[model samples]
Target chain A: MAIRKEKFTMIKVAAQNNIKADKIDEFIAIAKNLVAETRKYDAGCVRYELLQDVKNPQLLTMLEEWDDQEALNNHLLSQHFKDAMATFAGYLEKPGEINLYKTLA
Target chain B: MAIRKEKFTMIKVAAQNNIKADKIDEFIAIAKNLVAETRKYDAGCVRYELLQDVKNPQLLTMLEEWDDQEALNNHLLSQHFKDAMATFAGYLEKPGEINLYKTLA
Candidate 1:
Protein backbone atom coordinates (compact mmCIF):
# COMPACT_ATOMS: atom_id res chain seq x y z
CA MET A 1 0.00 0.00 0.00
CA ALA A 2 1.18 3.52 -0.81
CA ILE A 3 0.93 6.55 1.41
CA ARG A 4 -1.62 9.00 0.08
CA LYS A 5 -0.37 12.48 -0.76
CA GLU A 6 -3.63 14.36 -0.99
CA LYS A 7 -4.04 17.57 1.02
CA PHE A 8 -0.30 17.78 1.72
CA THR A 9 0.11 21.38 0.62
CA MET A 10 -0.12 23.00 4.03
CA ILE A 11 3.16 23.07 5.97
CA LYS A 12 3.32 22.57 9.71
CA VAL A 13 6.52 23.37 11.56
CA ALA A 14 7.74 22.25 14.95
CA ALA A 15 10.84 24.08 16.01
CA GLN A 16 12.18 22.74 19.29
CA ASN A 17 14.73 24.66 21.27
CA ASN A 18 16.41 24.01 24.61
CA ILE A 19 16.84 27.34 26.22
CA LYS A 20 19.21 27.97 29.09
CA ALA A 21 17.34 27.75 32.37
CA ASP A 22 18.14 31.31 33.32
CA LYS A 23 17.23 32.64 29.89
CA ILE A 24 13.71 31.18 29.67
CA ASP A 25 12.02 34.44 30.53
CA GLU A 26 14.11 36.42 28.06
CA PHE A 27 13.63 33.91 25.29
CA ILE A 28 9.86 33.87 25.78
CA ALA A 29 9.66 37.64 25.78
CA ILE A 30 11.39 37.82 22.42
CA ALA A 31 9.36 34.90 21.12
CA LYS A 32 6.07 36.54 22.09
CA ASN A 33 7.05 39.64 20.15
CA LEU A 34 8.04 37.55 17.15
CA VAL A 35 4.77 35.65 17.31
CA ALA A 36 2.78 38.86 17.34
CA GLU A 37 4.69 40.34 14.40
CA THR A 38 4.52 37.16 12.32
CA ARG A 39 0.79 36.74 12.84
CA LYS A 40 0.09 40.39 12.07
CA TYR A 41 2.32 40.77 9.03
CA ASP A 42 3.14 37.44 7.45
CA ALA A 43 0.86 36.33 4.66
CA GLY A 44 -0.52 32.79 4.68
CA CYS A 45 0.53 32.20 8.27
CA VAL A 46 -2.36 30.27 9.69
CA ARG A 47 -0.95 29.82 13.17
CA TYR A 48 2.24 30.77 15.01
CA GLU A 49 2.49 30.16 18.70
CA LEU A 50 5.07 29.06 21.28
CA LEU A 51 4.62 26.20 23.71
CA GLN A 52 6.53 25.28 26.84
CA ASP A 53 6.87 21.76 28.03
CA VAL A 54 4.82 21.02 31.14
CA LYS A 55 7.56 18.86 32.68
CA ASN A 56 10.56 20.75 31.37
CA PRO A 57 10.37 24.49 31.20
CA GLN A 58 13.61 24.77 29.25
CA LEU A 59 12.16 22.92 26.30
CA LEU A 60 10.33 25.40 24.11
CA THR A 61 8.58 24.52 20.90
CA MET A 62 7.22 26.80 18.23
CA LEU A 63 4.04 25.35 16.74
CA GLU A 64 3.41 26.88 13.36
CA GLU A 65 1.07 26.35 10.46
CA TRP A 66 1.65 27.83 7.02
CA ASP A 67 -0.51 27.83 3.92
CA ASP A 68 2.29 26.35 1.79
CA GLN A 69 6.01 26.12 1.22
CA GLU A 70 6.25 29.59 -0.28
CA ALA A 71 4.74 31.20 2.79
CA LEU A 72 7.09 29.22 5.02
CA ASN A 73 10.08 30.20 2.94
CA ASN A 74 9.06 33.85 3.09
CA HIS A 75 8.82 33.60 6.86
CA LEU A 76 12.39 32.29 7.03
CA LEU A 77 13.64 35.35 5.17
CA SER A 78 11.47 37.91 6.90
CA GLN A 79 13.18 40.59 8.99
CA HIS A 80 11.33 39.68 12.15
CA PHE A 81 12.48 36.08 11.88
CA LYS A 82 16.06 37.17 11.43
CA ASP A 83 15.82 39.54 14.36
CA ALA A 84 14.46 36.82 16.63
CA MET A 85 17.07 34.35 15.44
CA ALA A 86 19.85 36.75 16.35
CA THR A 87 18.62 37.05 19.91
CA PHE A 88 17.73 33.39 20.18
CA ALA A 89 21.29 32.39 19.28
CA GLY A 90 22.75 33.51 22.60
CA TYR A 91 19.87 32.15 24.67
CA LEU A 92 19.72 28.61 23.35
CA GLU A 93 21.49 25.82 25.19
CA LYS A 94 22.20 24.21 21.86
CA PRO A 95 21.11 24.51 18.25
CA GLY A 96 17.38 24.15 17.70
CA GLU A 97 15.74 21.29 15.83
CA ILE A 98 13.26 22.33 13.17
CA ASN A 99 11.00 19.75 11.60
CA LEU A 100 8.54 20.44 8.81
CA TYR A 101 5.47 18.28 8.28
CA LYS A 102 2.44 17.78 6.09
CA THR A 103 -1.01 16.98 7.40
CA LEU A 104 -1.87 13.32 7.01
CA ALA A 105 -5.32 13.36 8.64
CA MET B 1 12.62 37.60 36.35
CA ALA B 2 9.89 35.01 36.78
CA ILE B 3 8.10 33.18 33.99
CA ARG B 4 4.57 34.52 34.02
CA LYS B 5 1.89 31.82 34.15
CA GLU B 6 -1.10 33.65 32.72
CA LYS B 7 -3.15 32.12 29.89
CA PHE B 8 -1.82 28.63 30.52
CA THR B 9 -5.16 26.94 30.60
CA MET B 10 -5.04 25.46 27.11
CA ILE B 11 -3.31 22.05 26.83
CA LYS B 12 -1.31 21.15 23.74
CA VAL B 13 -0.07 17.66 23.04
CA ALA B 14 2.47 16.30 20.61
CA ALA B 15 2.50 12.55 20.31
CA GLN B 16 5.34 11.25 18.15
CA ASN B 17 5.47 7.73 16.84
CA ASN B 18 7.67 5.79 14.49
CA ILE B 19 5.78 3.31 12.39
CA LYS B 20 7.28 0.27 10.70
CA ALA B 21 7.82 0.96 7.01
CA ASP B 22 5.60 -1.92 6.03
CA LYS B 23 2.84 -0.84 8.40
CA ILE B 24 2.78 2.86 7.57
CA ASP B 25 -0.34 2.63 5.47
CA GLU B 26 -2.18 0.55 8.03
CA PHE B 27 -1.14 2.89 10.80
CA ILE B 28 -2.33 5.93 8.90
CA ALA B 29 -5.66 4.38 8.04
CA ILE B 30 -6.40 3.72 11.67
CA ALA B 31 -5.11 7.16 12.60
CA LYS B 32 -7.32 8.93 10.09
CA ASN B 33 -10.36 7.18 11.49
CA LEU B 34 -9.22 8.07 14.98
CA VAL B 35 -8.79 11.70 13.99
CA ALA B 36 -12.23 11.90 12.44
CA GLU B 37 -13.90 10.29 15.42
CA THR B 38 -12.03 12.45 17.91
CA ARG B 39 -12.85 15.63 16.06
CA LYS B 40 -16.50 14.79 15.59
CA TYR B 41 -17.33 13.24 18.94
CA ASP B 42 -14.71 14.09 21.52
CA ALA B 43 -15.71 17.11 23.52
CA GLY B 44 -13.15 19.90 24.13
CA CYS B 45 -10.82 18.52 21.51
CA VAL B 46 -9.87 21.74 19.81
CA ARG B 47 -7.52 20.14 17.31
CA TYR B 48 -6.51 16.54 16.76
CA GLU B 49 -4.65 15.86 13.52
CA LEU B 50 -1.82 13.67 12.34
CA LEU B 51 1.30 15.10 10.75
CA GLN B 52 3.87 13.25 8.67
CA ASP B 53 7.45 14.40 8.75
CA VAL B 54 8.62 15.83 5.46
CA LYS B 55 12.01 14.15 5.73
CA ASN B 56 11.10 10.87 7.39
CA PRO B 57 8.08 9.02 6.12
CA GLN B 58 8.07 6.66 9.09
CA LEU B 59 7.76 9.45 11.62
CA LEU B 60 4.17 10.48 12.35
CA THR B 61 3.25 13.06 14.93
CA MET B 62 -0.19 13.77 16.27
CA LEU B 63 -0.60 17.47 16.94
CA GLU B 64 -3.43 18.06 19.36
CA GLU B 65 -4.94 20.93 21.30
CA TRP B 66 -7.44 20.63 24.12
CA ASP B 67 -9.46 23.10 26.13
CA ASP B 68 -7.78 22.09 29.39
CA GLN B 69 -6.20 19.29 31.39
CA GLU B 70 -9.54 17.81 32.32
CA ALA B 71 -10.50 17.48 28.67
CA LEU B 72 -7.17 15.91 27.84
CA ASN B 73 -7.49 13.48 30.72
CA ASN B 74 -10.95 12.52 29.55
CA HIS B 75 -9.57 11.82 26.09
CA LEU B 76 -7.17 9.29 27.59
CA LEU B 77 -10.10 7.39 29.06
CA SER B 78 -12.13 7.56 25.87
CA GLN B 79 -13.18 4.26 24.31
CA HIS B 80 -12.15 5.46 20.83
CA PHE B 81 -8.69 6.29 22.07
CA LYS B 82 -8.30 2.86 23.64
CA ASP B 83 -9.56 1.16 20.49
CA ALA B 84 -7.07 3.03 18.34
CA MET B 85 -4.21 2.24 20.72
CA ALA B 86 -4.83 -1.50 20.54
CA THR B 87 -4.47 -1.53 16.75
CA PHE B 88 -1.54 0.89 16.87
CA ALA B 89 0.47 -1.41 19.15
CA GLY B 90 1.73 -3.79 16.49
CA TYR B 91 2.35 -1.14 13.85
CA LEU B 92 4.73 0.98 15.90
CA GLU B 93 8.48 0.61 15.73
CA LYS B 94 8.74 1.52 19.39
CA PRO B 95 6.73 3.05 22.19
CA GLY B 96 5.33 6.45 21.22
CA GLU B 97 6.41 9.56 23.08
CA ILE B 98 3.59 11.79 24.28
CA ASN B 99 4.38 15.25 25.51
CA LEU B 100 1.99 17.75 27.01
CA TYR B 101 2.59 21.46 26.75
CA LYS B 102 1.12 24.80 27.71
CA THR B 103 0.93 27.74 25.35
CA LEU B 104 3.36 30.45 26.34
CA ALA B 105 2.51 32.99 23.71
Candidate 2:
Protein backbone atom coordinates (compact mmCIF):
# COMPACT_ATOMS: atom_id res chain seq x y z
CA MET A 1 0.00 0.00 0.00
CA ALA A 2 1.44 3.31 -1.08
CA ILE A 3 1.23 6.15 1.45
CA ARG A 4 -1.43 8.56 0.25
CA LYS A 5 -3.41 11.34 1.88
CA GLU A 6 -7.15 11.26 2.48
CA LYS A 7 -9.58 11.90 5.29
CA PHE A 8 -12.54 9.78 6.37
CA THR A 9 -15.40 11.15 8.39
CA MET A 10 -17.96 8.83 9.91
CA ILE A 11 -19.20 7.77 13.31
CA LYS A 12 -19.79 4.12 13.91
CA VAL A 13 -21.13 1.97 16.69
CA ALA A 14 -19.80 -1.56 17.05
CA ALA A 15 -21.55 -3.81 19.51
CA GLN A 16 -21.62 -7.47 20.39
CA ASN A 17 -24.56 -9.50 21.67
CA ASN A 18 -24.08 -13.04 22.83
CA ILE A 19 -27.29 -15.02 23.09
CA LYS A 20 -28.00 -18.24 24.91
CA ALA A 21 -27.75 -21.31 22.74
CA ASP A 22 -31.45 -22.11 22.94
CA LYS A 23 -32.58 -18.52 22.44
CA ILE A 24 -30.62 -17.74 19.31
CA ASP A 25 -33.60 -17.92 16.99
CA GLU A 26 -35.75 -15.88 19.32
CA PHE A 27 -33.09 -13.22 19.66
CA ILE A 28 -32.71 -12.93 15.90
CA ALA A 29 -36.44 -12.56 15.47
CA ILE A 30 -36.58 -9.69 17.89
CA ALA A 31 -33.43 -8.11 16.48
CA LYS A 32 -34.77 -8.10 12.93
CA ASN A 33 -37.75 -6.13 14.11
CA LEU A 34 -35.52 -3.69 15.89
CA VAL A 35 -33.33 -3.07 12.85
CA ALA A 36 -36.31 -2.33 10.63
CA GLU A 37 -37.83 0.01 13.17
CA THR A 38 -34.55 1.86 13.63
CA ARG A 39 -34.06 2.29 9.92
CA LYS A 40 -37.53 3.64 9.45
CA TYR A 41 -37.81 5.96 12.40
CA ASP A 42 -34.31 7.30 12.81
CA ALA A 43 -33.22 9.61 10.07
CA GLY A 44 -29.88 10.15 11.74
CA CYS A 45 -29.06 6.50 11.32
CA VAL A 46 -27.31 6.13 8.00
CA ARG A 47 -27.23 2.37 8.43
CA TYR A 48 -28.04 -0.20 11.11
CA GLU A 49 -27.14 -3.82 10.66
CA LEU A 50 -27.15 -7.07 12.60
CA LEU A 51 -24.58 -9.70 11.69
CA GLN A 52 -24.09 -13.32 12.76
CA ASP A 53 -20.67 -14.81 13.20
CA VAL A 54 -19.84 -17.33 10.49
CA LYS A 55 -18.08 -19.71 12.91
CA ASN A 56 -20.42 -19.23 15.86
CA PRO A 57 -23.96 -18.27 14.91
CA GLN A 58 -24.92 -17.51 18.47
CA LEU A 59 -22.43 -14.65 18.59
CA LEU A 60 -23.96 -11.58 16.95
CA THR A 61 -22.85 -8.05 16.32
CA MET A 62 -24.46 -4.77 15.37
CA LEU A 63 -22.73 -2.27 13.10
CA GLU A 64 -24.33 1.15 13.02
CA GLU A 65 -23.56 4.49 11.45
CA TRP A 66 -24.93 7.82 12.55
CA ASP A 67 -24.54 11.35 11.30
CA ASP A 68 -22.73 12.37 14.46
CA GLN A 69 -22.41 11.87 18.17
CA GLU A 70 -25.60 13.77 18.92
CA ALA A 71 -27.58 11.66 16.52
CA LEU A 72 -26.38 8.44 18.07
CA ASN A 73 -27.10 9.75 21.54
CA ASN A 74 -30.64 10.62 20.55
CA HIS A 75 -31.25 7.19 19.10
CA LEU A 76 -29.95 5.49 22.20
CA LEU A 77 -32.34 7.54 24.34
CA SER A 78 -35.33 7.00 22.10
CA GLN A 79 -38.34 4.97 23.13
CA HIS A 80 -37.48 2.31 20.57
CA PHE A 81 -34.15 1.67 22.23
CA LYS A 82 -35.73 1.47 25.67
CA ASP A 83 -38.38 -0.88 24.45
CA ALA A 84 -35.85 -2.93 22.58
CA MET A 85 -33.78 -3.34 25.68
CA ALA A 86 -36.87 -4.49 27.55
CA THR A 87 -37.53 -7.25 25.05
CA PHE A 88 -33.87 -8.29 25.20
CA ALA A 89 -34.08 -9.08 28.89
CA GLY A 90 -32.98 -12.60 29.77
CA TYR A 91 -31.96 -13.25 26.16
CA LEU A 92 -28.30 -12.23 26.31
CA GLU A 93 -25.58 -14.43 27.72
CA LYS A 94 -24.09 -11.30 29.24
CA PRO A 95 -24.25 -7.54 28.86
CA GLY A 96 -21.94 -7.78 25.87
CA GLU A 97 -19.62 -5.10 24.57
CA ILE A 98 -20.33 -1.93 22.63
CA ASN A 99 -17.91 0.68 21.37
CA LEU A 100 -17.91 3.85 19.31
CA TYR A 101 -15.46 4.80 16.57
CA LYS A 102 -14.51 7.50 14.14
CA THR A 103 -13.10 6.62 10.79
CA LEU A 104 -9.44 7.32 10.08
CA ALA A 105 -10.02 6.97 6.35
CA MET B 1 -37.83 -3.80 20.04
CA ALA B 2 -41.21 -5.05 18.86
CA ILE B 3 -41.21 -8.42 17.14
CA ARG B 4 -41.74 -7.81 13.45
CA LYS B 5 -40.63 -9.55 10.28
CA GLU B 6 -38.01 -8.25 7.88
CA LYS B 7 -35.23 -9.69 5.81
CA PHE B 8 -31.77 -8.25 5.22
CA THR B 9 -29.27 -9.61 2.74
CA MET B 10 -25.71 -8.36 2.66
CA ILE B 11 -22.18 -9.67 3.12
CA LYS B 12 -20.05 -7.91 5.70
CA VAL B 13 -16.46 -8.25 6.83
CA ALA B 14 -15.44 -7.29 10.33
CA ALA B 15 -11.80 -7.03 11.17
CA GLN B 16 -9.54 -5.75 13.89
CA ASN B 17 -6.02 -4.30 13.74
CA ASN B 18 -4.14 -3.81 16.93
CA ILE B 19 -1.18 -1.66 16.04
CA LYS B 20 1.93 -1.21 18.11
CA ALA B 21 1.54 1.98 20.11
CA ASP B 22 4.45 3.63 18.32
CA LYS B 23 3.30 2.62 14.85
CA ILE B 24 -0.33 3.71 15.17
CA ASP B 25 0.12 6.86 13.13
CA GLU B 26 2.02 5.06 10.42
CA PHE B 27 -0.66 2.39 10.29
CA ILE B 28 -3.42 4.96 9.84
CA ALA B 29 -1.53 6.67 7.08
CA ILE B 30 -1.09 3.43 5.18
CA ALA B 31 -4.68 2.43 5.88
CA LYS B 32 -6.14 5.65 4.53
CA ASN B 33 -4.26 5.16 1.28
CA LEU B 34 -5.50 1.59 0.99
CA VAL B 35 -9.09 2.58 1.66
CA ALA B 36 -9.08 5.24 -1.04
CA GLU B 37 -7.53 2.91 -3.54
CA THR B 38 -10.00 0.16 -2.78
CA ARG B 39 -12.97 2.50 -3.06
CA LYS B 40 -11.78 3.83 -6.36
CA TYR B 41 -10.96 0.50 -7.92
CA ASP B 42 -13.61 -1.88 -6.64
CA ALA B 43 -17.11 -1.74 -8.09
CA GLY B 44 -18.64 -4.40 -5.88
CA CYS B 45 -17.53 -2.74 -2.69
CA VAL B 46 -20.61 -0.96 -1.44
CA ARG B 47 -18.87 0.50 1.58
CA TYR B 48 -15.46 0.12 3.15
CA GLU B 49 -14.72 1.80 6.43
CA LEU B 50 -11.91 2.05 8.98
CA LEU B 51 -12.73 3.04 12.50
CA GLN B 52 -10.75 3.72 15.66
CA ASP B 53 -12.04 2.75 19.07
CA VAL B 54 -13.14 5.73 21.14
CA LYS B 55 -11.70 4.33 24.34
CA ASN B 56 -8.59 2.75 22.89
CA PRO B 57 -7.27 4.50 19.84
CA GLN B 58 -4.82 1.72 19.12
CA LEU B 59 -7.64 -0.69 18.49
CA LEU B 60 -9.06 -0.31 15.01
CA THR B 61 -11.86 -2.06 13.20
CA MET B 62 -12.77 -2.27 9.58
CA LEU B 63 -16.37 -2.75 8.41
CA GLU B 64 -16.88 -3.57 4.78
CA GLU B 65 -19.85 -4.47 2.61
CA TRP B 66 -19.87 -6.29 -0.66
CA ASP B 67 -22.64 -7.19 -3.04
CA ASP B 68 -22.14 -10.93 -2.53
CA GLN B 69 -19.74 -13.63 -1.58
CA GLU B 70 -18.12 -13.64 -5.01
CA ALA B 71 -17.39 -9.93 -4.84
CA LEU B 72 -15.90 -10.23 -1.38
CA ASN B 73 -13.85 -13.21 -2.47
CA ASN B 74 -12.53 -11.23 -5.39
CA HIS B 75 -11.50 -8.44 -3.07
CA LEU B 76 -9.67 -10.79 -0.78
CA LEU B 77 -7.76 -12.12 -3.75
CA SER B 78 -6.98 -8.73 -5.29
CA GLN B 79 -3.56 -7.19 -5.71
CA HIS B 80 -4.61 -4.28 -3.50
CA PHE B 81 -5.20 -6.65 -0.60
CA LYS B 82 -1.84 -8.29 -1.18
CA ASP B 83 -0.09 -4.94 -1.25
CA ALA B 84 -1.93 -3.71 1.82
CA MET B 85 -0.98 -6.82 3.76
CA ALA B 86 2.61 -6.32 2.78
CA THR B 87 2.64 -2.76 4.11
CA PHE B 88 1.10 -3.99 7.37
CA ALA B 89 4.05 -6.21 8.18
CA GLY B 90 5.74 -5.58 11.54
CA TYR B 91 3.23 -2.84 12.40
CA LEU B 92 0.76 -4.93 14.33
CA GLU B 93 0.83 -5.59 18.02
CA LYS B 94 -0.91 -8.87 17.34
CA PRO B 95 -2.07 -10.85 14.31
CA GLY B 96 -5.54 -9.30 14.68
CA GLU B 97 -8.88 -10.90 13.90
CA ILE B 98 -11.01 -10.85 10.80
CA ASN B 99 -14.39 -12.45 10.28
CA LEU B 100 -17.18 -12.64 7.75
CA TYR B 101 -20.89 -12.33 8.43
CA LYS B 102 -24.27 -12.37 6.76
CA THR B 103 -26.71 -9.80 7.99
CA LEU B 104 -29.75 -11.18 9.84
CA ALA B 105 -31.87 -8.09 9.16
Candidate 3:
Protein backbone atom coordinates (compact mmCIF):
# COMPACT_ATOMS: atom_id res chain seq x y z
CA MET A 1 0.00 0.00 0.00
CA ALA A 2 1.17 3.52 -0.70
CA ILE A 3 2.04 5.59 2.32
CA ARG A 4 0.22 8.86 2.94
CA LYS A 5 0.71 11.56 5.51
CA GLU A 6 -1.65 11.55 8.48
CA LYS A 7 -4.03 14.46 8.03
CA PHE A 8 -5.38 14.87 11.53
CA THR A 9 -4.67 14.62 15.28
CA MET A 10 -6.94 13.80 18.30
CA ILE A 11 -8.11 15.29 21.56
CA LYS A 12 -10.75 14.41 24.15
CA VAL A 13 -12.76 16.60 26.49
CA ALA A 14 -15.12 15.64 29.34
CA ALA A 15 -17.44 17.88 31.31
CA GLN A 16 -18.42 17.48 34.94
CA ASN A 17 -22.19 17.26 34.84
CA ASN A 18 -24.60 19.47 36.72
CA ILE A 19 -27.21 19.74 34.02
CA LYS A 20 -30.21 17.54 34.87
CA ALA A 21 -30.35 14.38 32.77
CA ASP A 22 -33.74 15.43 31.47
CA LYS A 23 -32.31 18.68 30.16
CA ILE A 24 -29.09 17.26 28.75
CA ASP A 25 -30.47 17.61 25.26
CA GLU A 26 -30.63 21.34 25.70
CA PHE A 27 -27.06 21.44 26.97
CA ILE A 28 -25.81 19.00 24.36
CA ALA A 29 -27.23 21.07 21.56
CA ILE A 30 -25.32 24.15 22.61
CA ALA A 31 -22.11 22.21 22.83
CA LYS A 32 -22.82 20.49 19.53
CA ASN A 33 -23.46 23.80 17.86
CA LEU A 34 -20.22 25.18 19.22
CA VAL A 35 -18.27 22.24 17.81
CA ALA A 36 -19.92 22.35 14.40
CA GLU A 37 -19.02 25.98 14.04
CA THR A 38 -15.48 25.25 15.05
CA ARG A 39 -14.94 22.13 12.94
CA LYS A 40 -17.12 22.74 9.95
CA TYR A 41 -16.59 26.46 9.57
CA ASP A 42 -13.07 26.67 10.92
CA ALA A 43 -10.42 26.09 8.27
CA GLY A 44 -7.89 24.08 10.26
CA CYS A 45 -10.18 21.48 11.78
CA VAL A 46 -10.25 18.15 10.00
CA ARG A 47 -12.95 16.28 11.91
CA TYR A 48 -14.93 16.55 15.14
CA GLU A 49 -17.57 14.53 16.99
CA LEU A 50 -19.35 14.42 20.33
CA LEU A 51 -19.43 11.10 22.13
CA GLN A 52 -21.58 10.48 25.21
CA ASP A 53 -20.21 8.07 27.73
CA VAL A 54 -22.53 5.06 27.78
CA LYS A 55 -21.69 4.29 31.40
CA ASN A 56 -22.60 7.85 32.33
CA PRO A 57 -24.86 9.84 30.07
CA GLN A 58 -24.13 12.86 32.21
CA LEU A 59 -20.53 12.71 31.09
CA LEU A 60 -20.04 14.42 27.72
CA THR A 61 -16.92 13.76 25.68
CA MET A 62 -15.76 15.50 22.52
CA LEU A 63 -13.54 13.81 20.00
CA GLU A 64 -11.78 16.06 17.52
CA GLU A 65 -8.95 16.02 15.01
CA TRP A 66 -7.06 18.89 13.47
CA ASP A 67 -4.41 19.29 10.81
CA ASP A 68 -1.95 19.83 13.66
CA GLN A 69 -1.45 21.91 16.76
CA GLU A 70 -1.06 25.05 14.67
CA ALA A 71 -4.38 24.45 12.96
CA LEU A 72 -5.88 23.89 16.38
CA ASN A 73 -4.26 26.99 17.82
CA ASN A 74 -5.68 29.04 15.01
CA HIS A 75 -9.16 27.65 15.63
CA LEU A 76 -8.99 28.63 19.28
CA LEU A 77 -8.21 32.22 18.41
CA SER A 78 -10.86 32.60 15.73
CA GLN A 79 -13.78 34.97 16.32
CA HIS A 80 -16.32 32.16 16.31
CA PHE A 81 -14.36 30.37 19.03
CA LYS A 82 -14.46 33.43 21.21
CA ASP A 83 -18.22 33.73 20.80
CA ALA A 84 -18.77 30.06 21.60
CA MET A 85 -16.45 30.13 24.61
CA ALA A 86 -18.21 33.09 26.18
CA THR A 87 -21.55 31.31 26.56
CA PHE A 88 -20.45 27.70 26.72
CA ALA A 89 -18.52 28.19 29.93
CA GLY A 90 -21.69 29.25 31.70
CA TYR A 91 -23.47 25.97 30.90
CA LEU A 92 -20.92 23.86 32.71
CA GLU A 93 -21.88 23.33 36.33
CA LYS A 94 -18.31 22.27 37.00
CA PRO A 95 -15.03 22.72 35.27
CA GLY A 96 -14.43 20.23 32.44
CA GLU A 97 -11.43 18.05 31.61
CA ILE A 98 -9.48 17.58 28.37
CA ASN A 99 -6.90 15.06 27.15
CA LEU A 100 -4.45 15.25 24.25
CA TYR A 101 -2.48 12.53 22.52
CA LYS A 102 -0.48 11.61 19.42
CA THR A 103 -1.42 8.35 17.75
CA LEU A 104 1.21 5.72 18.56
CA ALA A 105 -0.48 2.35 18.52
CA MET B 1 -15.52 31.99 43.39
CA ALA B 2 -12.44 33.24 41.63
CA ILE B 3 -12.00 31.77 38.19
CA ARG B 4 -8.83 29.81 37.71
CA LYS B 5 -7.38 29.76 34.26
CA GLU B 6 -7.65 26.43 32.47
CA LYS B 7 -4.19 24.95 32.24
CA PHE B 8 -4.14 21.84 30.07
CA THR B 9 -5.87 21.10 26.79
CA MET B 10 -7.19 17.74 25.52
CA ILE B 11 -6.51 15.32 22.65
CA LYS B 12 -7.31 11.68 21.83
CA VAL B 13 -5.76 8.96 19.67
CA ALA B 14 -6.93 5.55 18.50
CA ALA B 15 -5.22 2.58 16.90
CA GLN B 16 -6.54 -0.14 14.62
CA ASN B 17 -5.29 -3.50 15.79
CA ASN B 18 -3.68 -6.43 14.05
CA ILE B 19 -2.01 -7.88 17.12
CA LYS B 20 -3.59 -11.08 18.38
CA ALA B 21 -5.90 -10.74 21.38
CA ASP B 22 -3.46 -12.42 23.76
CA LYS B 23 -0.51 -10.39 22.52
CA ILE B 24 -2.11 -7.08 23.38
CA ASP B 25 0.01 -6.83 26.48
CA GLU B 26 3.21 -6.60 24.50
CA PHE B 27 1.72 -4.19 22.02
CA ILE B 28 0.15 -2.11 24.78
CA ALA B 29 3.48 -1.82 26.57
CA ILE B 30 5.07 -0.36 23.50
CA ALA B 31 2.23 2.09 23.03
CA LYS B 32 2.34 2.95 26.73
CA ASN B 33 6.01 3.69 26.49
CA LEU B 34 5.42 6.15 23.68
CA VAL B 35 2.77 8.01 25.69
CA ALA B 36 4.78 8.11 28.90
CA GLU B 37 7.76 9.55 27.18
CA THR B 38 5.59 12.02 25.34
CA ARG B 39 3.83 13.26 28.49
CA LYS B 40 6.13 12.82 31.46
CA TYR B 41 9.47 13.55 29.90
CA ASP B 42 8.13 16.30 27.70
CA ALA B 43 7.96 19.50 29.72
CA GLY B 44 4.83 20.97 28.12
CA CYS B 45 2.53 18.00 28.68
CA VAL B 46 0.26 18.08 31.72
CA ARG B 47 -1.17 14.56 31.82
CA TYR B 48 -1.57 11.46 29.66
CA GLU B 49 -3.37 8.13 29.80
CA LEU B 50 -4.02 5.01 27.72
CA LEU B 51 -7.58 3.72 27.65
CA GLN B 52 -8.73 0.38 26.24
CA ASP B 53 -12.04 -0.09 24.48
CA VAL B 54 -14.24 -2.41 26.53
CA LYS B 55 -15.95 -3.98 23.53
CA ASN B 56 -12.75 -4.56 21.63
CA PRO B 57 -9.54 -5.57 23.27
CA GLN B 58 -7.81 -4.96 20.00
CA LEU B 59 -8.68 -1.30 20.11
CA LEU B 60 -6.61 1.21 22.12
CA THR B 61 -7.24 4.82 22.99
CA MET B 62 -4.99 7.54 24.38
CA LEU B 63 -6.08 10.46 26.51
CA GLU B 64 -3.73 13.39 27.03
CA GLU B 65 -3.56 17.01 28.13
CA TRP B 66 -1.06 19.73 27.50
CA ASP B 67 -0.55 23.23 28.85
CA ASP B 68 -2.01 24.39 25.54
CA GLN B 69 -1.33 24.01 21.85
CA GLU B 70 2.09 25.57 22.33
CA ALA B 71 3.17 23.08 24.96
CA LEU B 72 1.76 20.35 22.78
CA ASN B 73 3.69 21.70 19.83
CA ASN B 74 6.82 21.80 21.92
CA HIS B 75 6.31 18.22 23.03
CA LEU B 76 5.86 17.08 19.46
CA LEU B 77 9.32 18.38 18.56
CA SER B 78 11.14 17.19 21.65
CA GLN B 79 13.77 14.50 21.22
CA HIS B 80 11.75 11.86 23.06
CA PHE B 81 8.88 12.26 20.64
CA LYS B 82 11.20 11.80 17.69
CA ASP B 83 12.71 8.70 19.22
CA ALA B 84 9.31 7.28 20.08
CA MET B 85 7.99 8.05 16.62
CA ALA B 86 10.84 6.40 14.82
CA THR B 87 10.02 3.02 16.31
CA PHE B 88 6.36 3.51 17.18
CA ALA B 89 5.34 3.90 13.57
CA GLY B 90 6.58 0.43 12.71
CA TYR B 91 4.59 -1.38 15.41
CA LEU B 92 1.17 -0.28 14.26
CA GLU B 93 -0.47 -2.92 12.11
CA LYS B 94 -2.73 -0.22 10.71
CA PRO B 95 -2.81 3.55 10.84
CA GLY B 96 -3.71 5.25 14.12
CA GLU B 97 -6.09 8.18 14.60
CA ILE B 98 -6.11 11.32 16.77
CA ASN B 99 -8.59 14.02 17.80
CA LEU B 100 -8.28 17.54 19.24
CA TYR B 101 -10.85 19.60 21.15
CA LYS B 102 -11.39 22.60 23.34
CA THR B 103 -13.31 21.99 26.58
CA LEU B 104 -16.61 23.80 26.10
CA ALA B 105 -19.09 21.69 28.00
* Per-residue lDDT of A13 in model 3: 27
Candidate 3 CA-lDDT value: 0.61
For candidate 3, lDDT tens digit of each residue in B1-105?
999987655543222344456657776787687776775577656666666543455656656666667777787788866775676555655666454544543
CA-only RMSD, every prediction: 5.7, 7.6, 17.3
Please provide, for model 2 over B1-105, each residue's C-alpha lDDT reduced to its tens digit, 9 standing for 90 to 100: 899765445688888888899998888888888789889987689989888998899898787988877788788788987788887878888888887888777
Residue A58 local lDDT, model 1: 96
Better of 1 and 3 by DockQ: 1
- Residue pairs in collision within model 1: none
lDDT of 1 by residue, A1-105 (tens): 998877647899999999999999999999999999999999999999999999999999999999999999999999999999998999999887788999988
What DockQ would candidate 2 receive versus the native complex?
A: 0.64
lDDT of 2: 0.84
TM for candidate 2 is 0.83
* Segments of candidate 1 deviating more than 4 angstroms: A1-8, B1-8
- DockQ for each of the predicted structures, in order? 0.76, 0.64, 0.04
